[model samples]
Each structure stands twice: as C-alpha cells, then as structure tokens.
Target chain A: MNPMNYVILAAILFSIGSAAVLLRRNAIVAFMGVELMLNAANLALVAFSRIHGELNGQIMAFFVMVVAAAEVVVGLAIIIAVFRARQSISLDEPAELKG
Target chain B: MQSLIWLAIALPLASAAVLLLAGRRADAWGHWVGVAASGAAFLVGFFALIEMLGKPAEERALDTTLYTFIPGSDLQVDVGLLADPLSITFVLLITFVGTLIHVYSVAYMEHDKDRRRFFAYLNLFVAAMLLLVLADSYLLLFVGWEGVGLASYLLIGFWNHKPEYATAANKAFVVNRIGDIGLIIAMGIMFTTFGALDFATVGQLAGNASTTTLTAIGLALLLAACGKSAQFPLQSWLGDAMAGPTPVSALIHAATMVTAGVYLIVRSAPIFNGAPDAQVVVAIVGAITLTLGALIGMAKDDIKKALAASTMSQIGYMMLAAGLGPIGYAFAIFHLVTHGFFKAGMFLGAGSVMHAMNDQVDMRRFGALKGAMVVTWVTFGLGWLAILGVPPFSGFWSKDKIIESAFVGEGWQPWVFGLTALIGAGLTAFYMSRLFFMTFHGKARWTDEVHPHESPALMTVPMIILAVGSAFLGLFLAVGDRFSHFLEPVTGHVEHHEPVLPVPVIMAATLILVAAGAVFAWLKYGRAEVAEEAPAGSLATITARNDFFQDSVNRAVFQRPGQHVTRTLVYADAAIVDGAVNKQARGWASIGEASRKVQNGQVRSYAATMLVGLVIVVAVIVVGGL
Candidate 1:
C-alpha cells in the first residue's frame, strides 16, 4: 500500500473522531471517538515510518499504547467516582461549571 | 576624609534604625537623637565647606565615585558625590537648617504621641536631602529625590488619624511621581546620548552635542524640576502640604524639597546653557509661577498657606535667575540661601503664632500679638523685610542682583526677567505685608479660649538665628569677584557683567518700589481703621480670595481630567483586565466540569464505551495501515 493512501485514511478517521467527540451528548460515544482519534494518529505515524524506513515510528507507537493503557486506568477511576456521585452519564448535563 | 562623608549619611540612618528598633521607647530620646544626628551632619558639612574653601579652586571640584552601579554596553551609572560650590552650598543649608528644625520639633512635637515616628521621619528626611544634594550623578540624586518624597509622605501624614492629612500625603507622593517620570526619561536620554549620568561628564557632553539633543535633555530635566518645585500647574500640592506640621512646611517647602528643581537645573547648567531654547522655557515657566504664586498669596487667609505660596513665588524668582544663564546661576543660589533663612524663620514664626493661638491658623482670627510674642514679632518682621527685598535686608540684595542681571544681560532676556521680577517684588511685598498686618498689627481678633503668647526659646532661637542670616547673608555677594573665584572651577565659566545700571540707580529703583508697596499696604491693611473695616466683596478681592481663578481653572481642567482618568479609565481598564483573566479561568473551569460528566454512575455504559473504543481504534489502525 502507498504510505500516502494510509496517511489520507488516518486524517479522515481523525477528523470524524474529533467531530464525534465534539457533537456527541453521550459520554460513551465521546470516549470511543477519542480512542479512534488516537489510533488514527498512531496509524499515520506507522505508515510514515514504513515509507521512511525508520524504527523511530515503531518505538513511538509502543509508547502510545502504554500511555493509552495508563490513561484508561485513571479515566476509569474518575468515571467510577463521578458515577458514585451523579448517577448519570450525560456529557451535556455534566457541564455544571459553564457560564 | 571619606569617613566624614560616610558619617554625614550614617548618623541619620543610625538614628532612624535606633528609632525603628526601639519603637515607642524611642520617643523620649527621639528628639535628642534627631538633633544630635543632624548636628553631627551639619558639623561634617561645615568641615566639608571649610575643606572645600581651603583647597585650590581646581581641587574644590571633588568627585567621589562609589562604583559603576549599572553595567551595560549602552550606558553606565556611578554612585558618586560631587562637592562642587553648588552642592556644598546646598549641603550647608540643608544640614544647618535641618538641625535647627529638628531642635524646634523637639519642643513643637513634645505633646504628640508619635514623637518617635516624627523624629525618625525627620532624620530620614535629612539623610535623603543630603544624599540628594551630595550625589554626584543623576541616578544617585534621583535616589535621594524619591527618598525625600517618601519621607515627605510619612511626615505630612504624621497625624495619620486625620483622613485629610493622609489624602494630602498621597497627593504629594503621586504628584511627585509624575515629575519623577520626567527625571527618569531625562536619565534615559542622557544614557543614550552621552553614555554617562555623572554631572561633570554629561555637562562635558552637552557642550558638544547637537542643539536638538541638548534641548531634549534640557526640556526633560525642566519637566522634572517643575514637578519637584511645584511650579504653575503642579503647584496645588504645596498649598495642601500645609496639612503637614508647621516645621515640615518650613523645612521642605522653604529650605529643601522645593529647591531641588532649582538645584537640578543649576547642577545641569551646562546642559541648559547649551540649549538656549530650553533656558527660555525655564525663564517663562519661572515668570508664570512667580506671577501665579504671588497672586495666590494675596488671597490666602491662613498664615502658613500664604507663606507656602510665597515659597513657590520665591522659588520662581530663583528659577527665573537660573534661566538667565551663567550670570543668573550665582544670583539664583544666593537668593536660594537667603530665602531659606527668612522663609524658614517666617514659617516658624507662623507656627509660633498658631502655637500661641490655640492652633488657629487663620490670620483672620489673629491680631495684636506683636506685643505678646516679642521675639517672634521681631524675627518675623526681619524675615518679612528680607522676603520683600527691602533695602538693607538679605532679600533686597539677592533680588536686586537677579533683577539687575535680567535687565543688563544679553539681548531682551534681561528686560523680560527684570520686568517680571519687578512685578513679582511688588506683589510679594503687598501680600507679605497683608499677612503681617492681619496677624500681628490690629486689634485682638481671637475669642477667649485663644490667648496669644510667646513660643519657648527652642523655637524662637532658630528664628532669631535665621533672622540674622536673612539680614546679612546677601552682603557676601558685594565682593563678587572673590565669590566667583571660589565657585569658578566647579561652575565652569562665570559670566561677569559690568553694572550697566549704576548701583545707585538700581538701589534707588528697588527702594522706591519697596517703599511704594509698603506705603500702599500700610494705607490699605496696616492702618487700624482700614483693617477694622471688613474686606469689601469687590471683584478684585473675590479674585484674589479665589486665587485669581487659577484654582478653579485647575479644578475644571487638570483635576477633573485626572479624576476621570482614575475613576473612569483606570478603574474601567482594571475591571476589563481582570474580567478577561477571570473569563479564561471560567472557561477552564467549564471544561473541567464537562469532563467530569463523562464519569457518571453507570458501569454498563462505561464497559460498552470501552469495547466500542477498542473496536474503533483497531478498525482505524488496521484499515488505514492496510
């Protein structure tokens, strides 16, 4: 596959994910959108590295996976706390600090 | 020898430190500490003067550069001292008069609860003034300049319990800050143009610089001087400064702070001489101040406030003289010294009157106390004579020189100066006599609770000495060649003018003017019948009483704009600035709130989202990378 085609696909996926994250009222949809954006960025990096013949992209992807795992642990803990307090999962209703 | 200079600075600082450390306990001994410190400083100044005089003229211009204070490619400033004729003269005046005022304050402030703080502030003022006069560079002078302003703020609001006094202090400090901006800009210009801030170096550079650069520097310094000296528009604060104690009015207004502007111009005379345009501006500003101050003085009923206006008027004469170039420099300094003696004495006398009359400052409430306070009466009479440029008194001689130089000098400059000085003299005599008659000559005006009496020797003694100085100090100039010879090396060229108007002619003209003013005043206000008659509600009286409409104009123009700026612009801008920052904080807070909602209490939803996220991530990477 041409690296350019992979890069184009990744950019499209990232834009779609960002739009989903911004527009969705559901917390679960937003979480999936964020994960899709991160994975799309990782895919773009891997494609560029393959075309350039560098190990640096592979190393960066490995670190991204580790960071994503750690983020999941912290995010779940935060979700559990919020669930205990609010008894709802609506992102729109959660904006209690807005002007 | 260096230790002597250090001692002059250290004594006052030490007193302040002791007062700060001892706090209220310092009150009992505070007066004595202040007196001793200032006395010691005066002695050092005396020694410095003696040493300065004994040296060859070349040796008299001593420069004690402390160190390079600022290290930069473009500019460097030195913390230094210049013991030239001008600085020496100012040092002697500040230290000597400061000592007397300190001693007088010991008695004047005896009943006050915050005597320690008063003494501390007074000592600090002396040190700051000494630093101001003794500093060799503009930067060091500025340090002392601001230091004096700080001390003035503390001293003016010594009775901090009074809201008005506190407000007056704030007004003085803020007005002075406005002037300080001029000094700072002048400094920056000096660095850019000359690469030095030392008076001698800058003076040397000013001689060679283009007229435009010199004019820029001169104008900047002139603005600074106007602010410090309270000239024209910046003069309102001096009247309000009467809210301070009487001695403060005496020391700061008469002897020290107000003279700083004159000193700055005189010290930078070379810069001014190089830029004749700037000198004209100085002369014109001086003339305006003289006219304004004298007119305002005519209208004041309060004795201290009138004298405050007189101080501004007298400083105007000095500024006028300074603007007359080299010939006027000596005259300005001479007038400055003589004015210090008489002005300080007059203010002290006014203070004595207030002290006797149950703290009543309104001259309308005073009359026929000349017999009761004999010393005050005599000393103040001499001061009045000296200030009015009366023949045979100190003011007459100095005023004569300034006026004569103005007419006799190059071009039409002399005529312009002479004319203004004449009018200023006439008005000065008229107002000063009015003040004297109202306070001392007529029937007793105060009620039973207020009885006039003599102040104690502590206050009267300084007045007596100052009276003598005011009467005789001007005679030193009669031997002009010797005086000029002594000052020449420090001042560069001393322009000597052959008396174009014969001494007899000048003296006769001045004497006639003086006598005319005195006779007119005697007829108008001095006679018992005239004084007994209530002042008429004539337009002139109303104008004089209203400070010739200048105060109203100031209120409408400057004061209102200033208030608007502070209340509307500054307040609005501050609110807007703060609002912008607060909005950003709110935005961040809202984002945090939105993020918090994602963790709502639903385990099933969280699990489903995690699975969906996993599938999306896997699909995006696999499909995109294929």
Candidate 2:
C-alpha cells in the first residue's frame, strides 16, 4: 500500500476511536474506545515502518499490544470496584473530581 | 596567615553553633562561649592590626582572593578578605566592644530564661559584623550586611513574646531593606560598569570610569549608607529599636550596625571622591541628620530614646566627615570608635537605671540616685562628657578634628560642620544634663512600688571599661602621626589643608555656650529649690513631659499611616479580595447543588450528553480534515 493510503486508514480509525471515547457514558464502552485508539496508533506505526523498511516499528507494535492487554485488565478491575461502590458504571458518575 | 584570618570569622560562628545545639542547658556555657569567642576574635583583630601596621606600604597592598562567591559573566564577586588599616580598626572595635557587651549581657540577662538564644544571637551579630568589615568584595560585604540585618532582626525580636518588640524588629528590618535596595542597585551598576564586585577591582575601575557611572554607583552607595547609618529620613527606626533588650540596642544602635553605613562610605571612599556630586548629597543628608537628631533628642523624655537620637546625631557627624573625603575618613572613623564607647556606655548605663528602677524608663520617675548608684552615675557622667565633646573627653578630640577638616576643606563644609556641631554640642549638653539631673540630682521621684538601686558588677564593669575608653580613646588620634601612619595604607594620601585655627577656636569658645546651657538646665530642672518651686502647670514641664511634641508628630505621620495600611490589608482580605474568592467558591458549590437535582441518578440525560459530544468530535474531524 502507498504511504498516503496507510495514513488515511490510520486517521479514520483514530477519529472513530476518539468519537467512541467521547460518546460513551458506560465504562465498558470507554474501555473499548481506549483499546481502539491503541490499535489505531499501532496500525499507523506498522504501516509507516513498512514503507520505510524498518523492523523497529513492528517491535514497538508488539510492546503496545502487550501493554494494552495489561491496561484493559487494570481498567476492568477499577470499573468493577466503581460499579460495586456506586451501582453504576457510567463515566459521568465517576467525574467527582472535575473542576 | 589565611588560617588566622579564617579563624577570625570562624570562632564566633563556632560559638553560635555550640550555643544553639546545646540549647538551654548551655546557657551558662553559652555566655562563657560568647565571651571566649569574642575574646579570640578580638585577639585576631589585634593581630591583624599588628600585621597591617607592621607591613611596609608596598607589602600592605596585598589583596588575597579567598574564592569566588558568585560566578556571573560580568558580575563576579569573590569571597575575599582585606586586612587594611581601616578594616583592622573596625574589626578591633567590633570584637573589643562585642566582647564587653557579651560580658555585660551575662549579668544583664542573667534573669532571663532563654539566655542561650540571647548569647547565640549576640555572637552571631558580632561574627556577621566582622564579616561585613572584613569582606573584600561588595557582594561579600552585602552578605555580611544582610547577615547583620538578620541578626539585628533576631536580636531585636529576641523577646518575641512582646508584640511591640516584634513590631519594632519588623520596622527595622523593612526600613533597612529599603537601603539594601540601594546596595543591590550599586552591585548591579558595578557589575555593568566594571564587570566585577571586588572592591579593589571596582576601585580601580571607578578611578578611570566616566563621571556618570561613578556618580550612579556613588549615589546608590550613599543611599545604602544613609539607611544603615540611620541618617535623616530613615532615622525613626532607631528610636523605636529601644524596645529591644538594652544590650542589643547598645550593640546595634551604638557600636556595630549603625556604624556599618560609615564603614561602607569609608570603604568606598574612592567612589565617593571620584563623584563629588554624590559626596555633596552625602554631606547634605548628614547635615540634616545632625540637626534633626539633635532637635529630636532635646524633646525626648525616655532616657534610652534620647540617647538613641543622640547616637543618630553623632553618626551624622561621622557621615559628614566621610562626605568631606579621605582626610575626613580618618576623623570619621576616629569619632566612630570614640562614639561607640561612649554611646554603648550611655545605653548600658541607661539599662542599669531601667533595671534598678524595676523597668521604669521615664526620666520623671527617677531622682537622687547619685549616692546609690555611684558606679552608674560616674560611668554615665563620663559617657555624657565624652558625647558632649567636653574638653579632654574622647568625643571632643574626634569631633574637633571633623569640624577642623570641614573648615579647612573645600566647599561650604566648614560652615555646615561648625554650625551643626556647635548647636548639636549645646543640645547634647542640655539634654544630657537634663537626663543627669532628672536621674541623680534632685529628690527621689519614684513611688512606693518602684525601688532604685545599682546594677550588678557584671553590668558596672563594662560600663567602667567603656567609661575609661570614652575618657581616653580620643588621645589615640592625638599621637601625632602614629594613627595616620598606621591607617595611611587604607586612607591613602589625604589632602591636608592649612589648619583652620579660627574655627577650632570658635568651636572651643562654643563650649562656654554649652556650659551656659547646662547651667540653665540646672537652674530650671536640677536645683533642689527649683524642683520644689516649679508648678506642674508650667509650659516647659508640659513640653518636656510630652517629649517636645515629637510624640504627636510620630503618631500623626508614621503611626497613623502604619495603622491605615494594616487596616486596609485586613479589610481587603476579609471583605473584598478574600470575599470574592469565597463567593466564587460558594457560587460553584450552589451551582453544583442545582445541577445535582437534575442528576436524579438518571442515565438518559448522560446518554444524551455523550451523544452530543460524540457528534461534535466526529463532525469537527470530518469537516476540518477535509
């Protein structure tokens, strides 16, 4: 694929992921949005590295996936705690410390 | 040699450290430690003096760089020491009198609970003042300058439990900071012009610098001197500083701190000499201080406050001498030494009176103690004589030289110095005699509750020594060229004009006038018959009782403005500034409460907001990217 095509695809995925994060009130949906954003960044990096013929980008992608999995587990645990305490998994309810 | 020089700085610091670490258990040890530290420092000063005096003119020009304190591109300042005749003289004065004051404080403060802290602060004050005098660089001198100021603040507020004392301390600190600003500006100018803060380098630069740069530096330095020396506009703080314990007043007001200004001007004599305009300003300020201090002294009823004003007046004389240039520097310093002894003695003697009268400071409450406190009376009498510049006293010799220098030197200096000195001398005699008569001559004026007695040997011993010093210290200058020769390296070649015999003769003749003033005071207030005959309704009595209208003036000018400022700040904090902040916080809390009612644990409203935010983000990305 051309570099321009790969950039367009990454940009579309990033936008969708950011929209998901903004639209979601549910903790589960927000977690999914975060995951999508991570994947979108990985896609861009891999595409760019392939165009440049570098292996470093692939290695970074692998690390990102591993870190994403860890983050999901932690995020789920925090959501579970909040749900148990407030009987709600809505992000709006958890915005207790906002200005 | 370096080690000994470092020892001079280190000894008092070590004593302060020990006193601080040991706490109250070290109180007894602290006093001894202070004595020992000052004694050792005084010894170092003596050695430095000996070394300085012994060196030939060529060898005496030795300038040793200890290290650099501030590493700026153009404003580098070295932590160095100069052992010149001038610095040696000051070091000797600080350490010698410091030791005596420390010794006196032992007995003077024996009854206080926190004696350790007192001795620690006193030792620190001496150490810092020594640093100021010995510093080779302006920046280093500033450190010492500010260090003395901090020590002054600490010593002034040593009895911090008293709000009045704390307020006085704050006033002194703030007022001195105004002067410190001038010092900072001077440093900035020196850095920009000369690229160095080392006195030697700056002096060399100043010699060849443009007149404008030299004047800027000179004026800035003069402002700094005026603050430190308690000249004119900044003179009020010293009077209020009498609220501190007496030893602090003696050390700061009389001996060490106030003299820092004169020391500064003398140290930078080259700068002032190069900038004659600035020197004129210095002379003018000094003249104002001379007249103002004497005028204020005349009306003061509190013995310490009167002496405090007298000290300011005397420092003005020294400043005037300094303003006259190199020839005046020696006379100024000579007067500084003599004035230190006499002023310290007077303050301590006043402290003795205060102590004896059970903390009563009003002169009206004191009388007929000449027999009871013979040592205090005699010592204080010597101090008065010395301060009045009476014949053969220390003040007479030094003061006469300054007046002579003024008369013989250029400009209208002789008339300024001669007139101010003569008037100041008469007022000095009048006020001091009034204080003496009020305290020792007439009938006992104390009520039944207050008993008058003599101070302890610890106090009287220092008074006796200082009294002896006051009686004879002037003769040091009279040793023909010995003093001038010793100080020649520091003072350089001062131009000596033809001896102004007529001015000295006129000044000597004015002593008769001073004597007449004393007699008048005696007839009006001192004689037993006059004391009995005078009605309480007399104008003189009312004016004297009210401190010659100065109390009202102070209340109107300083006290009212100070109170207004305080009230404004308090009001702003409580009603306007803080109120706005608090109101904002309360509004936010109320808004949150009103918003909370809409929440109702509802999921639908949240969903709607989320959808709207999602649409906004998506539409922006799609439209903007396109």
- Against the true structure, whose DockQ is highest? 2
Error of 1 at B57 (Å): 1.4
Query: Compared with the true structure, what per-residue lDDT tens digits does model 2 show for residues B1-626?
Result: 42367578889989998999988788667789888998999998787666755667656644567777667765566778877778878888888888889989998899999888998888899889989988888888998999999999898888989999999899889889989999999989888788888888887878888888888998899889888888867766788888889999998888878999999998998788899888878877887788677767766668888888888888998998888888888888888999999999988899899899888787777888888899999999998888877878888888877777766654566676667766767777787788788877887877689767888888999999999999988876667856666667777776657645576486766677679778877876688442332356567546644545555776898779999999999998899998999999999999998887755544445545766787799899999995
Please provide TM-scores, in order, for all candidate models, with all chains considered together: 0.83, 0.78
Give the CA lDDT, 0 to 100, for residue B314 in model 2. 88
The numbered model that scores best in lDDT is 1
Measure candidate 1: CA RMSD.
8.4
DockQ scores for all predicted structures: 0.04, 0.05
Local accuracy of candidate 1 as per-residue lDDT tens digits, B407-427: 766677666777888778888
Docking class of 2: incorrect
- Name the lDDT value of residue B438 in candidate 2: 81
Count clashing pairs, candidate 1: 3
In candidate 1 chain B, what residue range of length 10 has the lowest lDDT sum?
B528-537
Fnat value of model 2: 0.00
